[model samples]
Target: MTRSPLVLLGKIWLALILVFLYAPILVMAAMSFNASPFYQLPFQFSTDWYAKMAGNQQIITAAIRSVLIACGTTVIATCLGTAASVALFRYEFRGKRILQVLLFPPIAIPWLITGTAMLVFFFAIGIGRGTPAVVIGHVALALPYVIVTVSARLSSFDVTLEEAARSMGANAWTVLSRVTLPWIAPGIVAGALFAFAVSFDQFVVSYFLSEPGDSTLPVLIYTAIRKGFTPEINAISTIIVTVSMAVMFLAARFSKFGGSR
Candidate 1:
């Protein structure tokens, strides 16, 4: 059987796109294990970079901070975004469309602008720059993604199921806990993972909101890069990429974003 010219061309294009997207990450991961400090290529494998990263208190501290912030952001954004999504799905209000539109600007506007605005707002309210401000900033940045993700999952949900549960003597809370949540559980998980990734990888906003000597991993990595790149940086970066990719991969599987059942 002969493939159509257009189909063959599309496959070739997709292959090129995949290479373009992933080749740099592959190279970076390779270099992380390379013995060369300067990333000298003809690679000699070693775990030295990983060892170096472990002892670096600065990186370790920043990494812990990053995880904590991401966790906080995920919890706050998931709860709020999920509740908001449910409300949007179940209710009709005068400003329902406008309320939905409000979620977009945090996403539509560039983060730099949003970050700077947050800096100003926090300062005006005396929150100042620190982990608190960073968490707030991250949640704001992550909320829209969460809302959109859960909302998409909620769209295909059977409202009649909830109605049936109510008819069968389930209260609102019971209906939500048993009937509604189970069906949309995958979407919530996907949304939470997305929030974690956004907070974990956030640099620009974190940079602006974080206090001196206290910043997230991405901000620390940027500072390290400016000092001069090292194999340890490559190793840590590889870890970050691996973790984020793994999370999004799981999220894709759960959400069936690729249309897999």
Candidate 2:
């Protein structure tokens, strides 16, 4: 058809973009199961790398620490972000726009600059480099994302519902707990997932903040690659990618994008 050319071109561009985004991940996943340690082709399949990964105590310890940090970041980020979103949405004040604008700098600034800045600030404050420092950086990085997600959800909320609850003699806490929170539950879930993903996948900040004996998965992976590339790297890379994708998928399921609400 005469009109089909533009549609075909759009489809081709989308396919190219997807390949650009996902090709490396696909290749890494493929290599994880390959028998060759050197990333050789003609693909003989094996599970030895994963078995080796499982047996590595250092990797297991790092993985647990990563999960714990991500969980902590998620909980703190979600609660604070959801509350901030509500306050921002429910009230109007001078410099409120300025406050909202401030959130963007953390997200927009280069991670290298942010990471170094965090190190300097934490050192000045005596926190220094460690799990606490990493959490502080991760929460700062993740807070904006959670605020944006929950704010987007809150944009569709009806103010009259809160007014009606207040008219019925419900207190501030009662109205928020019974009305606003129920409506924003999906957004909170999605925001929490985003927080978890951000912290779990973080590298630069964690690299600067984590002490030598302890590191998050991404930081650990970077150190391993610097030493040498191995199939075990591929195995862990595949797992990280898989787990991150799974978290985002669940986030999508809980978001308004999923058509649940």
> In candidate 1, what are the lDDT values of residues 158-183, reduced to their tens digit?
99999999999999999999998998
lDDT of 2: 0.94
How well does candidate 1 match the true structure in TM-score terms? Answer: 0.95
lDDT of 2 by residue, 183-254 (tens): 988999999999999999999999999999899889989999999978888898899989999999999888
TM-score for each predicted model, relative to the true structure: 0.95, 0.94
Runs in model 1 lying further than 4 Å from the true structure: none
* lDDT of model 1, residue 59: 88
